[model samples]
Target: MQEWQNACQIAAESAWGVTTDATSVQSMAYDAVRDGTSLKSQHAILATHRVADTLRSITEKHDRGWDAPKPRFTSPTVVYDERSMSFLDDGTVSLATTEGRVSATLRLPDKKDGYQQQYLDDEAWEHTQSTLHERDGAFFLHIGFKKPAEPSRQPEYGTVLGVDLGIDNIAVTSTAQFFSGSELEHRRRQFRRKRRRLKETGTRSALRTLIGIENKERRIAREILHRVSNGIVAEAERYCCDIIAFEALDGIRNRLPAGDVFHSWAFRRLIEYTTYKARSAGIRVTRVSPEYTSQRCAECGHVEEANRSSRDEFVCQSCNARSNADYNAAKNIGERAVRCVQQSTQRTSVSRYALKSGTVTPDEGFTPRDGGVRG
Candidate 1:
C-alpha cells in the first residue's frame, strides 16, 4: 500500500509540475509503476486515474473563474471500485496492494435496529466505491453506496422549522430552542490559552503537543457539530415540520472579522450534516436570503437596524416586540423560506401558462417581469 501511494505521489507531482495534461502525465509515469514496481497492472492504471482526477479538478476550478494553483498532494489515499476490490461474506474486504492482494476484517459500528436489515439487503443498498485512508494511527475505510431514498411523507400542513447558526450558541431554532455552548466555549478558551503558552515557550515538544491538541479539538468539534445537527433535524421531525429553513450564509466571513471565534464555529459543517440527515427523512431544506434577518421583527413586519438593541437582545422599536435575537432571526428565516416557496410556485404557474400560450422563448427564458405575483 505504501509503495502504491509513493507511485501515485510521483505521478501527482509529475502531473502538477511537468504538465497539466493528464494523458501525457499518465503516459510518462505509467512505465515507472508498471515496470519498476511490484504493483499490479490494474493498480498502476488506478494511479494514473488519480493523476487524471487531480488535473481535471484543477482545470475545472480554473474554468469556474477561480485562480486555482496546481495542486500538490498532502496525504496519500487509495480509491478503489468494485473491480479492484471485493467484499467477502464474513464482513471482510479484499483489496489490491503493491505486495499482493490482501484482505482485512472490517470493524463496522452497530447501526440502528430498523436500518440494519435495509442496509444489509442488496436490493435496498449497493456499494459503489471505497476509499482507504490512515488517520491518527488508525486505518479507516470510507465506503460510498447507493440506497433507496424513502418516499417523501411531507406534511400537507405543518410548521416551518427555522435554524440560525452562529458562533455564540452554535444553533437557535424558531421553536425557541437554544443549543448553548457556555461550557464548551470555556473549554475552547482554555485550549486557546494553552496554545498561546506553548507558542511562547517555543520548545519542540510544546509545538508537537500543540499540534496534537489542535487535532483533538478538531475531532471534538466535529463530533459535537454532528450531534447538534442531529438534534436540530430530530426537532424538525418531532414538530412535523415540512420545511427546514436556513440563511444563505455564503461570504459571511467577509462581513465580519474572521478570527478564532469564526474559524472555530463549524456552521457550514453543521448545516451540511443537518441537510443530509433531513433529506434522508424526506424533509425539505430551503435557503433564504439572510439580509436584515437579525434586525427584522418576527412579531411584526418591522425592519430597522435599531431593532437589534444588542447581540443577544431584540426589542423592536416599532411594535415594542421583544424576543431572543437568534430566535427572532430564525423566525424571520422561516418566514422568508415560506415566501420563497410561494414565489417559486407562482413562477412555475406563470411559466406553464407561457409555455401553453407559445409566449415562452428559449433565449430570455423567464424573468421577474414575467412573474405576475408580487408583494
Candidate 2:
C-alpha cells in the first residue's frame, strides 16, 4: 500500500461523506502517537503534512499574483481506499489504511445504474480508470471508469483498426460514422457569430459572457465526443483488431484555439476516452507521428502538403492517390502504428524471437516477417 493510494481512497469515499471510523484512524496511528520520539520526528505526519505544505505554497502564489486565488480542491472530492484518518470541518480530509486499501485513490464517484446501461443523458458520472493530479486547491477527475469484465474481448484477428479525430468530424473511423457534423457545426457557427458580435462590443461584460459561450461549446463537443467515440470502439470490435491507432494529436488544441475566451479542445478528450475503452477490451492503442497521413498518398507514401485541399477531399501530388481526408488519416494511422510496432520489435533490446504457441505448428500463425500482414 503506497502512501498516495492510501490518500486517494479516503478522498473517493469521502465524496459520500463515508469516512473510515475516526477511532480506526487513530488506532492505526496510536503506535506512532504513543512514542514521543516518533511523533516529534520530521516524517511522522508525512501524508497530511505534505499536502498542507502544498496548500500553503499554492495560497501564497495566488495571493502575490493578479486575479483570484487558484482552485486546487475540486467539487465532489473522494479518495478510494485511502486510510481514513480524519475529516476536518473544512473540505480537507485525512485518510489511512490498515494493511491499507492502497489500491483505491480518491476520485469522483461513478456508480453503475440503469441510466448508464441504457446510455441515457450521457452526462451522468462514470468511474476514473487511473489516478491523476491534485494541485493548489483544485482537483480534476478523469470521469470514466474501467470497462466491466463481462464484455470479454475476443482476440481480434486483425492487428489494425484505423482512427481519425477532427474538430468538425470529432472522429472518423475506417468505417464511416452514422452521425454527421451538420447539426453540431451549425451550432458552432452560430456561437462563432455571436462571439464575433460580443468581441465588437469590446466591454468587460461581453468578455464575461464569452466564457459562458466557451463553456457551452465545450459541453457540446464533449457530449458529441462521448457518444461518438464509444460507438466507434464498439464498431471496431467487428474487425477483431488487436491494435487500434489514432493520429497523434501534436498540440492540435493550440493549433485551433477557440479564440482567447474558449480554449479547451474536446477532440483530444474523445481520443483519450476511446483509448481507455479500447485498452479495457484488451486492444492496443498506438499513436504514430502525424506527419502527413492525409496529404501523402497512402498508396505510394508521397509526401505533399497540397494534397489535402478541403476538409473532405484528399488529392496526392506524386502518386495520384486520393481519398476522404478523415479516411486517409485513419488508414495512415493504422499503417504507421504497424510499422512502428515492427520497428520496435527489431530494436536491439528485443531478442527478435517469439514463442510459437498452442494448438498450431511453429509457423502456422501469421508472422510479421512474412512481408507485413495487411490484415
Candidate that scores best on TM-score: 1
Cα RMSD, each candidate = 13.9, 14.6
* Whole-model lDDT, model 2: 0.50
Q: CA lDDT, every prediction?
A: 0.67, 0.50
Q: Which regions in candidate 2 have their CA more than 4 angstroms from the true location? A: 1-158, 198-209, 251-264, 304-311, 316-321, 345-375
lDDT by residue for model 1 (100-123), tens: 688998777657544433454566
Worst 10 residues of 2 by lDDT: 351-360
Evaluated at residue 136, the lDDT of candidate 1 is: 83
Query: What would the per-residue lDDT of candidate 2 be over residues 264-287, giving only the tens digit for each residue?
Result: 355566676576567656666667
